[model samples]
Target: MLSVQLFHNFNKYARITEADFGLIEQVLSKKFVKKRRTLLSEGDKSRYIYFVEKGALRSFTVDKDGVEHVIQLAIEEHWIADLYSFVTKAAGNINIEAIEDSEVWLLPHHELELLYEQIPALERYFRQLFQRAYVSLQQRLNLTVSSNAEDRYRQLLQDFPQIAARIPLIYIASFLGITPESLSRIRKQLFQ
Candidate 1:
Protein backbone atom coordinates (compact mmCIF):
# COMPACT_ATOMS: atom_id res chain seq x y z
CA MET A 1 0.00 0.00 0.00
CA LEU A 2 1.23 3.52 -0.75
CA SER A 3 1.99 5.41 2.42
CA VAL A 4 0.01 8.55 3.14
CA GLN A 5 3.19 10.34 4.16
CA LEU A 6 4.73 9.65 0.79
CA PHE A 7 1.62 11.01 -0.86
CA HIS A 8 1.73 14.03 1.41
CA ASN A 9 5.35 14.69 0.53
CA PHE A 10 4.56 14.55 -3.16
CA ASN A 11 1.52 16.75 -2.67
CA LYS A 12 3.46 19.26 -0.63
CA TYR A 13 6.07 19.49 -3.35
CA ALA A 14 3.55 19.30 -6.21
CA ARG A 15 0.54 20.93 -4.50
CA ILE A 16 -1.99 18.20 -5.26
CA THR A 17 -5.20 17.45 -3.33
CA GLU A 18 -6.61 14.41 -1.56
CA ALA A 19 -9.13 13.52 -4.27
CA ASP A 20 -6.39 13.73 -6.86
CA PHE A 21 -4.23 11.45 -4.75
CA GLY A 22 -6.97 8.86 -4.58
CA LEU A 23 -7.38 8.96 -8.32
CA ILE A 24 -3.65 8.55 -8.86
CA GLU A 25 -3.54 5.62 -6.48
CA GLN A 26 -6.34 3.94 -8.36
CA VAL A 27 -4.52 4.26 -11.69
CA LEU A 28 -1.02 3.40 -10.57
CA SER A 29 0.03 -0.19 -9.99
CA LYS A 30 2.98 -1.97 -8.42
CA LYS A 31 5.29 -4.33 -10.28
CA PHE A 32 8.14 -6.67 -9.44
CA VAL A 33 11.08 -7.53 -11.64
CA LYS A 34 13.59 -10.31 -11.11
CA LYS A 35 17.23 -9.63 -11.80
CA ARG A 36 18.01 -9.35 -15.53
CA ARG A 37 14.40 -8.74 -16.54
CA THR A 38 13.85 -6.25 -19.33
CA LEU A 39 11.30 -3.58 -18.44
CA LEU A 40 11.29 -1.61 -21.71
CA SER A 41 12.93 -2.49 -25.01
CA GLU A 42 14.16 -0.38 -27.85
CA GLY A 43 11.39 0.27 -30.41
CA ASP A 44 8.63 -0.36 -27.85
CA LYS A 45 6.35 2.36 -26.57
CA SER A 46 6.91 3.08 -22.92
CA ARG A 47 3.68 2.60 -21.00
CA TYR A 48 4.63 3.65 -17.53
CA ILE A 49 6.80 5.84 -15.35
CA TYR A 50 8.50 3.38 -13.05
CA PHE A 51 9.47 4.44 -9.55
CA VAL A 52 12.00 2.11 -7.97
CA GLU A 53 11.35 0.82 -4.50
CA LYS A 54 14.09 -1.80 -4.27
CA GLY A 55 17.17 -2.88 -6.19
CA ALA A 56 18.39 -1.24 -9.40
CA LEU A 57 17.68 -0.67 -13.10
CA ARG A 58 19.79 0.51 -16.02
CA SER A 59 18.73 2.22 -19.23
CA PHE A 60 20.96 1.89 -22.25
CA THR A 61 21.20 1.84 -26.01
CA VAL A 62 23.32 -0.21 -28.37
CA ASP A 63 25.36 1.54 -30.99
CA LYS A 64 25.92 0.56 -34.62
CA ASP A 65 28.99 -1.41 -33.56
CA GLY A 66 26.82 -3.34 -31.07
CA VAL A 67 28.49 -1.71 -28.10
CA GLU A 68 26.09 -0.89 -25.29
CA HIS A 69 26.25 2.60 -23.82
CA VAL A 70 24.58 3.21 -20.52
CA ILE A 71 22.29 6.23 -20.33
CA GLN A 72 21.09 6.14 -16.73
CA LEU A 73 20.67 3.98 -13.66
CA ALA A 74 17.93 4.08 -11.04
CA ILE A 75 17.98 2.59 -7.59
CA GLU A 76 15.67 2.66 -4.61
CA GLU A 77 13.52 5.82 -4.50
CA HIS A 78 14.56 6.82 -8.01
CA TRP A 79 12.42 6.97 -11.12
CA ILE A 80 13.26 5.44 -14.52
CA ALA A 81 11.58 5.83 -17.87
CA ASP A 82 12.17 6.74 -21.47
CA LEU A 83 10.66 10.19 -21.19
CA TYR A 84 10.52 10.80 -24.93
CA SER A 85 8.48 7.72 -25.61
CA PHE A 86 6.32 8.19 -22.53
CA VAL A 87 5.45 11.73 -23.45
CA THR A 88 5.23 11.46 -27.20
CA LYS A 89 3.63 8.04 -27.39
CA ALA A 90 6.26 6.80 -29.75
CA ALA A 91 8.68 3.90 -29.83
CA GLY A 92 11.61 4.30 -27.44
CA ASN A 93 15.23 4.34 -28.45
CA ILE A 94 16.51 3.10 -25.10
CA ASN A 95 16.02 -0.14 -23.24
CA ILE A 96 15.38 -0.42 -19.53
CA GLU A 97 16.49 -3.60 -17.73
CA ALA A 98 16.70 -4.66 -14.14
CA ILE A 99 20.14 -5.05 -12.61
CA GLU A 100 18.70 -6.83 -9.59
CA ASP A 101 15.35 -8.10 -8.35
CA SER A 102 13.33 -4.93 -7.93
CA GLU A 103 10.02 -3.48 -6.87
CA VAL A 104 8.48 -0.56 -8.74
CA TRP A 105 5.39 1.58 -8.79
CA LEU A 106 4.09 2.02 -12.33
CA LEU A 107 2.09 5.05 -13.46
CA PRO A 108 0.38 4.85 -16.81
CA HIS A 109 0.44 7.93 -19.03
CA HIS A 110 -3.26 8.16 -19.82
CA GLU A 111 -4.38 7.71 -16.25
CA LEU A 112 -1.81 10.24 -15.15
CA GLU A 113 -3.14 12.65 -17.76
CA LEU A 114 -6.59 12.31 -16.24
CA LEU A 115 -5.24 13.35 -12.88
CA TYR A 116 -3.37 16.21 -14.53
CA GLU A 117 -6.57 17.61 -16.01
CA GLN A 118 -8.64 17.21 -12.87
CA ILE A 119 -5.85 18.71 -10.82
CA PRO A 120 -3.67 21.21 -12.62
CA ALA A 121 -1.29 21.07 -9.68
CA LEU A 122 -0.36 17.54 -10.72
CA GLU A 123 0.71 18.91 -14.10
CA ARG A 124 2.85 21.50 -12.35
CA TYR A 125 4.51 18.72 -10.38
CA PHE A 126 5.37 16.84 -13.54
CA ARG A 127 6.63 20.04 -15.12
CA GLN A 128 9.01 20.49 -12.22
CA LEU A 129 10.06 16.88 -12.53
CA PHE A 130 10.85 17.40 -16.21
CA GLN A 131 12.83 20.51 -15.44
CA ARG A 132 14.95 18.64 -12.95
CA ALA A 133 15.51 15.77 -15.37
CA TYR A 134 16.58 18.15 -18.10
CA VAL A 135 19.01 19.96 -15.82
CA SER A 136 20.58 16.67 -14.78
CA LEU A 137 20.92 15.64 -18.39
CA GLN A 138 22.70 18.88 -19.19
CA GLN A 139 25.09 18.37 -16.28
CA ARG A 140 25.83 14.83 -17.42
CA LEU A 141 26.56 16.04 -20.93
CA ASN A 142 28.91 18.67 -19.58
CA LEU A 143 30.71 16.09 -17.49
CA THR A 144 31.04 13.67 -20.40
CA VAL A 145 32.60 16.30 -22.62
CA SER A 146 34.90 17.86 -20.03
CA SER A 147 35.91 14.99 -17.75
CA ASN A 148 38.30 12.15 -18.40
CA ALA A 149 37.09 8.56 -18.05
CA GLU A 150 38.82 8.02 -14.72
CA ASP A 151 37.46 11.26 -13.38
CA ARG A 152 33.98 10.31 -14.57
CA TYR A 153 34.21 6.95 -12.85
CA ARG A 154 35.42 8.59 -9.65
CA GLN A 155 32.55 11.06 -9.72
CA LEU A 156 29.99 8.33 -10.23
CA LEU A 157 31.39 6.36 -7.32
CA GLN A 158 31.51 9.43 -5.12
CA ASP A 159 27.90 10.31 -6.01
CA PHE A 160 26.44 6.84 -5.65
CA PRO A 161 28.60 4.69 -3.40
CA GLN A 162 26.00 1.96 -3.11
CA ILE A 163 26.27 1.41 -6.88
CA ALA A 164 29.92 0.42 -6.43
CA ALA A 165 28.88 -2.55 -4.29
CA ARG A 166 25.56 -3.48 -5.89
CA ILE A 167 26.15 -3.02 -9.62
CA PRO A 168 28.46 -5.05 -11.81
CA LEU A 169 31.69 -3.22 -12.56
CA ILE A 170 31.10 -3.64 -16.31
CA TYR A 171 27.80 -1.76 -16.20
CA ILE A 172 29.37 0.96 -14.11
CA ALA A 173 32.20 1.07 -16.61
CA SER A 174 29.81 1.54 -19.49
CA PHE A 175 27.97 4.22 -17.57
CA LEU A 176 31.25 6.04 -17.03
CA GLY A 177 32.10 5.75 -20.73
CA ILE A 178 34.93 3.30 -20.06
CA THR A 179 35.48 -0.26 -21.16
CA PRO A 180 35.22 -2.96 -18.53
CA GLU A 181 38.94 -3.77 -18.81
CA SER A 182 39.74 -0.10 -18.35
CA LEU A 183 37.56 0.06 -15.26
CA SER A 184 39.27 -3.04 -13.86
CA ARG A 185 42.64 -1.39 -14.37
CA ILE A 186 41.43 1.73 -12.62
CA ARG A 187 40.07 -0.28 -9.70
CA LYS A 188 43.33 -2.19 -9.35
CA GLN A 189 45.33 1.04 -9.38
CA LEU A 190 43.05 2.67 -6.82
CA PHE A 191 43.24 -0.27 -4.43
CA GLN A 192 47.01 -0.43 -4.73
Candidate 2:
Protein backbone atom coordinates (compact mmCIF):
# COMPACT_ATOMS: atom_id res chain seq x y z
CA MET A 1 0.00 0.00 0.00
CA LEU A 2 2.79 2.40 0.89
CA SER A 3 4.74 1.40 -2.15
CA VAL A 4 1.74 2.16 -4.33
CA GLN A 5 1.31 5.57 -2.74
CA LEU A 6 5.01 6.33 -3.07
CA PHE A 7 4.87 5.31 -6.67
CA HIS A 8 1.93 7.56 -7.32
CA ASN A 9 3.66 10.48 -5.63
CA PHE A 10 6.82 9.92 -7.67
CA ASN A 11 5.10 8.97 -10.91
CA LYS A 12 5.05 12.51 -12.25
CA TYR A 13 8.66 13.22 -11.43
CA ALA A 14 10.42 9.87 -11.52
CA ARG A 15 9.63 6.21 -11.31
CA ILE A 16 10.55 4.24 -8.23
CA THR A 17 12.04 0.96 -9.29
CA GLU A 18 11.24 -2.33 -7.55
CA ALA A 19 14.65 -2.31 -5.87
CA ASP A 20 14.09 1.17 -4.51
CA PHE A 21 10.70 0.17 -3.20
CA GLY A 22 12.21 -2.83 -1.49
CA LEU A 23 14.80 -0.71 0.20
CA ILE A 24 12.20 1.79 1.38
CA GLU A 25 10.00 -1.00 2.67
CA GLN A 26 12.92 -2.42 4.60
CA VAL A 27 14.19 0.83 6.13
CA LEU A 28 11.00 2.81 6.68
CA SER A 29 8.79 2.08 9.68
CA LYS A 30 5.10 2.83 9.96
CA LYS A 31 3.64 4.28 13.10
CA PHE A 32 0.30 5.56 14.29
CA VAL A 33 -0.37 8.65 16.34
CA LYS A 34 -3.57 9.66 18.04
CA LYS A 35 -4.98 13.13 17.70
CA ARG A 36 -3.24 15.85 19.74
CA ARG A 37 -0.16 13.70 20.33
CA THR A 38 3.17 15.30 19.69
CA LEU A 39 5.39 13.69 17.10
CA LEU A 40 8.19 16.09 17.92
CA SER A 41 8.36 18.82 20.47
CA GLU A 42 10.28 22.05 20.79
CA GLY A 43 13.88 21.37 21.92
CA ASP A 44 13.82 17.74 20.79
CA LYS A 45 16.22 16.62 18.09
CA SER A 46 14.28 15.59 14.97
CA ARG A 47 15.23 12.05 14.16
CA TYR A 48 12.94 11.14 11.32
CA ILE A 49 11.09 12.63 8.40
CA TYR A 50 7.54 11.41 8.08
CA PHE A 51 5.28 10.83 5.14
CA VAL A 52 1.62 10.83 5.98
CA GLU A 53 -0.18 7.65 5.07
CA LYS A 54 -3.45 8.71 6.64
CA GLY A 55 -4.91 11.73 8.45
CA ALA A 56 -3.23 15.09 9.10
CA LEU A 57 -0.56 16.76 11.23
CA ARG A 58 0.42 20.32 12.02
CA SER A 59 3.68 21.96 12.97
CA PHE A 60 3.64 24.96 15.25
CA THR A 61 5.50 26.90 17.90
CA VAL A 62 4.59 28.89 20.95
CA ASP A 63 5.50 32.51 21.39
CA LYS A 64 7.07 33.95 24.54
CA ASP A 65 3.60 34.76 25.81
CA GLY A 66 2.54 31.13 25.20
CA VAL A 67 0.42 31.90 22.16
CA GLU A 68 0.55 29.10 19.63
CA HIS A 69 1.39 29.86 16.02
CA VAL A 70 0.83 27.40 13.24
CA ILE A 71 3.56 26.94 10.72
CA GLN A 72 2.38 24.24 8.31
CA LEU A 73 -0.25 21.54 7.84
CA ALA A 74 0.40 18.13 6.37
CA ILE A 75 -2.33 15.92 5.00
CA GLU A 76 -2.26 12.51 3.39
CA GLU A 77 0.69 11.92 1.08
CA HIS A 78 2.41 14.99 2.50
CA TRP A 79 5.72 15.13 4.32
CA ILE A 80 6.55 16.88 7.60
CA ALA A 81 9.74 17.56 9.55
CA ASP A 82 11.77 20.37 10.96
CA LEU A 83 14.17 20.49 8.04
CA TYR A 84 16.68 22.59 9.96
CA SER A 85 16.89 20.13 12.84
CA PHE A 86 16.46 17.06 10.66
CA VAL A 87 19.43 18.04 8.55
CA THR A 88 21.58 19.70 11.19
CA LYS A 89 20.89 17.26 14.05
CA ALA A 90 20.04 20.18 16.32
CA ALA A 91 17.08 20.61 18.59
CA GLY A 92 13.80 21.38 16.84
CA ASN A 93 12.27 24.74 17.55
CA ILE A 94 8.77 23.67 16.61
CA ASN A 95 6.26 21.02 17.63
CA ILE A 96 4.60 18.56 15.30
CA GLU A 97 1.27 17.31 16.56
CA ALA A 98 -1.21 14.91 15.13
CA ILE A 99 -4.43 16.66 14.14
CA GLU A 100 -6.18 13.32 13.74
CA ASP A 101 -5.39 9.66 14.30
CA SER A 102 -2.68 9.36 11.69
CA GLU A 103 -0.53 6.73 10.09
CA VAL A 104 2.93 7.93 9.14
CA TRP A 105 5.78 6.24 7.33
CA LEU A 106 9.06 7.35 8.76
CA LEU A 107 12.50 7.41 7.15
CA PRO A 108 15.38 7.99 9.48
CA HIS A 109 18.24 10.26 8.45
CA HIS A 110 20.77 7.45 8.65
CA GLU A 111 18.66 5.13 6.55
CA LEU A 112 18.09 7.96 4.09
CA GLU A 113 21.83 8.31 3.69
CA LEU A 114 22.01 4.62 3.01
CA LEU A 115 19.23 4.93 0.48
CA TYR A 116 21.17 7.69 -1.29
CA GLU A 117 24.25 5.55 -1.38
CA GLN A 118 22.48 2.38 -2.44
CA ILE A 119 20.11 3.95 -4.89
CA PRO A 120 21.49 6.95 -6.75
CA ALA A 121 17.99 7.86 -7.88
CA LEU A 122 16.89 8.25 -4.25
CA GLU A 123 19.12 11.33 -3.96
CA ARG A 124 17.49 12.86 -7.00
CA TYR A 125 14.10 11.97 -5.60
CA PHE A 126 14.82 13.74 -2.28
CA ARG A 127 16.39 16.69 -4.07
CA GLN A 128 13.12 17.17 -5.89
CA LEU A 129 11.25 16.76 -2.61
CA PHE A 130 13.39 19.47 -1.01
CA GLN A 131 12.82 21.76 -3.94
CA ARG A 132 9.08 21.41 -3.63
CA ALA A 133 9.22 21.91 0.13
CA TYR A 134 11.30 25.09 -0.29
CA VAL A 135 8.89 26.47 -2.83
CA SER A 136 5.96 25.66 -0.57
CA LEU A 137 7.56 27.46 2.39
CA GLN A 138 8.35 30.47 0.21
CA GLN A 139 4.78 30.64 -1.02
CA ARG A 140 3.41 30.29 2.50
CA LEU A 141 5.64 33.12 3.70
CA ASN A 142 4.56 35.30 0.79
CA LEU A 143 0.90 34.67 1.56
CA THR A 144 1.31 35.34 5.26
CA VAL A 145 3.05 38.63 4.56
CA SER A 146 1.00 39.87 1.61
CA SER A 147 -2.48 38.43 1.92
CA ASN A 148 -5.32 39.33 4.23
CA ALA A 149 -6.99 36.83 6.53
CA GLU A 150 -9.84 36.06 4.18
CA ASP A 151 -7.44 35.65 1.31
CA ARG A 152 -5.33 33.29 3.32
CA TYR A 153 -8.36 31.24 4.32
CA ARG A 154 -9.51 30.98 0.73
CA GLN A 155 -6.04 30.04 -0.41
CA LEU A 156 -5.79 27.40 2.29
CA LEU A 157 -9.07 25.91 1.17
CA GLN A 158 -7.93 26.00 -2.42
CA ASP A 159 -4.71 24.24 -1.55
CA PHE A 160 -6.16 21.67 0.84
CA PRO A 161 -9.92 21.49 0.87
CA GLN A 162 -10.05 18.46 3.14
CA ILE A 163 -8.27 20.44 5.83
CA ALA A 164 -11.26 22.66 6.40
CA ALA A 165 -13.31 19.63 7.35
CA ARG A 166 -10.67 17.88 9.44
CA ILE A 167 -8.92 20.70 11.30
CA PRO A 168 -10.52 22.77 14.02
CA LEU A 169 -11.59 26.33 13.31
CA ILE A 170 -9.09 27.61 15.89
CA TYR A 171 -6.24 25.74 14.29
CA ILE A 172 -7.26 26.93 10.86
CA ALA A 173 -7.35 30.44 12.21
CA SER A 174 -3.91 30.10 13.72
CA PHE A 175 -2.54 28.69 10.50
CA LEU A 176 -4.02 31.63 8.62
CA GLY A 177 -2.67 34.11 11.15
CA ILE A 178 -6.13 35.24 12.16
CA THR A 179 -8.16 35.15 15.32
CA PRO A 180 -10.79 32.48 15.82
CA GLU A 181 -13.64 35.00 15.83
CA SER A 182 -12.28 36.55 12.67
CA LEU A 183 -12.15 33.16 11.00
CA SER A 184 -15.73 32.50 12.06
CA ARG A 185 -16.81 35.75 10.44
CA ILE A 186 -14.82 34.96 7.35
CA ARG A 187 -16.47 31.56 7.01
CA LYS A 188 -19.90 33.13 7.20
CA GLN A 189 -18.88 35.72 4.64
CA LEU A 190 -17.45 33.01 2.36
CA PHE A 191 -20.75 31.18 2.05
CA GLN A 192 -22.81 34.31 1.52
Which ranges in model 1 have alpha carbons more than 4 Å from their true place? 3-12, 16-19
Best by TM-score: 2
lDDT of 2 by residue, 74-187 (tens): 888888999889999999898999999999988999889888888877788889989988998899889989998899889889988998888999899998888999999999
Cα RMSD (Å) per model? 2.0, 1.4
Clashes of each: 0, 0
Q: Candidate 2 — number of clashing residue pairs?
A: 0
Candidate 2: segments with Cα more than 4 A from true spot: 1-3
The residue-by-residue lDDT of candidate 1 on 1-192, one tens digit each, is 575544764665587677778878888788889999999999999989988878899999999999999988888867899999999999999999999998888999988888888888888977887888899888778888998877887888888888777889889888888889999998898889
Candidate 2 weakest lDDT stretch, 10 residues: 6-15
Pairs that collide in candidate 1 are: none
Best by the lDDT measure: 2
